[model samples]
Target: MRPLDPDDPRSVETAGRAYRVLARIGSGGMGVVYLGRSAGGRAVAIKMVHPEFAADPEFRDRFAREAGLARTVGGGFTAAVIDADPEAEIPWLVTEYLPSVSVRDAVHSSGPLAADAVWDLAAGIAEALVSIHGEGVVHRDLNPANVLLTADGPRVIDFGIARAIEASSVSRPGARAGAAGFMSPEQAAGDAVGTAGDVFSFGSTLVFAATGREPFGEGPWHVRMRRVQSEAPDLDGVEGDLRALIESCMERDPERRPTAAELAERLTGRAGASAEGAGAAGEGGMASLPPAVTAEIARRRTAAENPPVPRPRLEPPAPLAPLPSSPQPWPAGPGRYAPHSTMDPAQARRPRTPLIAAAAFVALLITIGIPGGLWFTVRDTGGGVEAAPSAGPTPTASAAPASPSPTGIRGELTFTIEGSGRVSSLTYMFNGKTTKLTKVRLPWEKTLQIPSWPPRIPWKLSYTCPPGGSSDSVAVDGNVIIRGQGSSGTNMRSEGVL
Candidate 1:
């Protein structure tokens, strides 16, 4: 038997049979998906509903209806339902696992699909929607993320929020179900949704696949919603028949939009023609996909077959050592330099016989006589005093200034980025404010002067590099030195006091 994934707890089981959860494949508002193997050793994608939602009868009913609808949607483009248990403590459903990457990831990693590949993708998704709508189910959520690109073709997998066309509400009040940029205008406006809403979402998804951006433009949720409801979709880079088809699908009035079956017919160039021979023709048309698309599909398949190894857990760091103590001042004495008059009473009352006698002897020697300007020097050695002859002129004793030294403290904040790509941007956050640094060349070093304050002033530094690279915030205090290493996609960081 294959070993259970240590990273995922094995507390969950479906229908009294244990499924070794290999890893968490995806998650969304409704539930979490896990990559697992059945008792019979079949790979499956298991979606378990959130515990909080399982307690609500309304949500449970909706979940059961979604599973029933999904079971009815049978096609080559849809993942078949393997097993499900909606009445369980945490209702769960399982489907055949497809080793593929989502359309969003494919476009993000390899840029937009070529024109021909976009056509193939559109055809596949439209066909899936046909099978889905035939079962009287509306896939309320159909964004690029829900469409998986596989070697054979694309598959529409996540039906968590799918509801029957006759259902009272798409979702509970105050809760929006679909993605922002792809939701239909009617759906965004909280109006009754229908199969046409999915068609609108399909058109938006195609726009993203063709241009590597959202059709309605990206921003805050309200802005995207406003654009979807009022503004024309930004389809600048889209071209040709596909563009026209997308425009037709995005009609402002739901009644004017064509059905999913009609879209599939149009995409496969079989409009107004018999349904026979359409599948063969569609297959033949997609057989000649662009080399880039083929390579990306192959790459995705390989990745799915061999998912990345989980990183090891890091141990807690050791505690820091304490700082050293400051030095203390020395005691006072008498001679030419007598004890300060402000000395403590206890110390001042102590006898000064030896010191007084020495002072008197020096005074007698100076007064009783000596020739040629004799010189004498007295030094305090902690235990007693010592006298020595001076070779040069005797130095005069001067009083120390009654103030601390006049020195200013300053420091430098140095950032050394050792990546291969050029730095695109850098910013530092301190004292509730953020400061952006000028872009610098690769393998760069820059320094900013910092005025002295407290010994430790907390700071957070962030950096970004060209061609998609970013460093996690490097947090430190006082004078900081940051070192960043690695190429565009994989960067590491280190910090030290300057």
Candidate 2:
């Protein structure tokens, strides 16, 4: 068994019942997910919300309502909710554990799925959505991360952002819900959404599985949002029946898009058939996945059954015999150590050699106007004095100006927002131009590389949250700084020099 992380909770309880947390498996903007075991020995995935959000009444209410809806969903293509405590000091929900990799990871590691495999994936996800929507819950965030590819099929998980059909807002005002590339146009626009939104997201996910790229081309969050809203998806490499089905689901008009039930029927060749017939047809879909997928699933199961043994680490070789202590005298020079023969044995034994060397080093630094606290080696090159390079603070005048390298910014720009209020947008002004970041989630911290530009460029950052709450703006002066304030009047700041 793998050792537990230091930060993993030893145990957690709800309603006075305890669960031994084994390890952390995942984390997101809202909470951390832990692998845990109940007293009954059943394993579960426990999602614990950040403590800061637990105090927000709105968040608690939403959490409770969603967890209740999630309990109503039942199917082979989805993980079942086991327990939840939305009122707990740290709100948490537990679901049956499914040991599987996400479709995202699968595609990243093994490339895009074959046409048959993509069809199987679509059918499984559509069935999951049918069950989820049948329970009157809309999974607002149905992206790749929320879909788990198991031996049985792809099991839809993570209904944390789900809400009832009648609920007006999935998130606070001005804050859009769902992931950027997977969101439907309506979702990106912050408009009322329903089961259709999930269909659009499902279509996008299929495109990703088939082509290993988001339907919308990559860029900043806002750019992806624009493409989702206005531009046709770049389905260049996708073709055949799979292409037609994905295109139907991705129709711009929500009314024109196929429902999850309809999608399952069409993909399984049971279109215009009765519900029972469609169910029977869909049952055979998983058996049709590409041989590669089946092989991968079997390989994974076998590996799980028998974990690899860790190899023992070889001990490092013993340090070479201490070089024979040679009685070498310091080279004679004006600013160098004198010959040992010139010093008495008593003086050398007095431990004054370091003191004398230090004094001479200090004098040399003063003479050369070198910065203090810097270590330098002075050498006589037979004719002139030479100094070894010093690993210290750069000199003000001679130092090269820090700038974004050809590859990109030398470092990353991080934004961390705390408290109950959500961030609606983040704007960065650089070189007389402004880029607005609208895809950020509330109570989220993200680090992204800045676009390449000249060194010492002046920049500014501004963000918007709930109105009437005090928020701060920070100026970017070629140095890293974390600046933001919470809705509850909590101040936050951090700095890192590149």
Candidate 3:
């Protein structure tokens, strides 16, 4: 991973700090997170306040307060804030980077986990919520992205949108668009949020994981809003303990939903009983048992292999071996004696001597011609060639008609210039060196074709427009360079010169 670009609006700069940024891990409304490493090689997730919010001093102060509150609720299911600098240019806070997949990605890629995994996820989230609520913080945004599925359990992330119940106001300008399908009715209505909102969001997330669908309507923002505010969440496909638990969490009345502690206990009890039943079943089936996961293998093999869908841990096998190197001679009659056929060293040396001498004579002549060859080349160019010795430089070879000699090449290039501007010529440059084009013509609107060219080299194309307007981009073979002027100006050009 490379360190996030400091100039990138999504990247946070903590220069002179002990840690070095590795790469951007994720971003949310409040800030972007970077996976970074300390001088001591410890992996940490660094979140810097979005510059838009950092401009507001009040938001920074609130972030600092919330960060302190977040630090207090460290436990099994929450990412604990390790360090923070709320006063930096891009106020950044660091946390532990638990190597895990987000709930959204897990469900989307693998479809969904089994019932056991879902139960574990629900219990972990409930326990984490209890700690968060105990510390006077309410996670206003608890969507699938914030819920991470790790080996230990699910861990909740992103508390920038969280509210402290003690504060008089938690809402900021457009605060957070708390996930559409997960927001509680109060949150959707822009009313005050309580612990129940977190529970509701968590339940909605679980429902999404179970069914691979949102609990509310999809499409435009207005439609989703209508569903969140008025429609009852459909828990039709939800089964097991999840059905009852989700129902309680998503109850319209906040008072009717169970507390975080209560939900955690219920889910934990279900998990324990399920584990006991699984173990008992295993014991009872011992007499008629098959190999571990053997039935699963048979079931999968019986189905069609969907090629378009990537199957991890699987690749086509290697090809067969080639034919033998040489043909074997037929066996002689009963091992009859034969004359010795091995060649003497002197005989082998005699044949190679003349060839070696001829090669030496040729090499000597080539060595002698080196200086003469250089002089001829310089003389042909009028001795105007200069050798500054740089990475790349434009060739000043004299223009000539296209020939099969491979000295220079010319071809038609269609330029698709997007912009409301007039293009003069498409100039080609090698590396950072500029090429002086002698002739130019527009083959099409925003397209240019040049003739009598030079040999193809690693190069890029730049476009020039009237009134000194220029387009930025360099492409190989100058096939597709878009050029244009104005904010929405786009131009596609093709140039062939080598």
- Model 1 poorest 10 in a row by lDDT: 473-482
**Residue-by-residue lDDT tens digits, candidate 2, 238-296:** 89777888889899999999998888777664221222222331343343444555667
Best by TM-score: 2
Considering TM-score, which of the candidate structures 2 and 3 is the better prediction for this target? 2
Using TM-score, rank the candidates from best to worst.
2, 1, 3
How close is every model to the real structure, measured as TM-score? Answer: 0.56, 0.60, 0.53
Give the CA lDDT, 0 to 100, for residue 122 in model 2: 81
330-349: candidate 1 lDDT, tens digit per residue:
34454344343355788668
Looking at model 2, report the run of 10 residues with the lowest lDDT sum. Answer: 473-482
Q: Residue-wise lDDT of candidate 3 within 1-498, one digit each (tens)? A: 122332433323345556666564544434556676666676778877545556667767777888887788766677877777778876778887766667776776667556766776677778788778888888887888788754345678875444421121222223234565678988777688889888888888889878888888454333454587899987878986678889999988899999999987777655422212222212211111122223433332232121112112322223222212232333334776434344458855555554445445433333333221221111112212221222333332232212323222233333232323455555554424555443243222222233322222233455554343332321112211122232222332322222
Instruction: For model 3, state the Cα shift of residue 101 in Å.
Output: 0.4
Steric clash count of candidate 1:
0
Q: CA lDDT of 452 in candidate 2?
A: 39
Which segments of candidate 1 are over 4 A away from where they belong?
1-18, 160-172, 269-498
lDDT of 3 at 286: 10
Clash count for each candidate, listed in order shown: 0, 0, 13
Query: lDDT score, residue 105, model 3?
Result: 66
Please give the lDDT score for candidate 2: 0.62
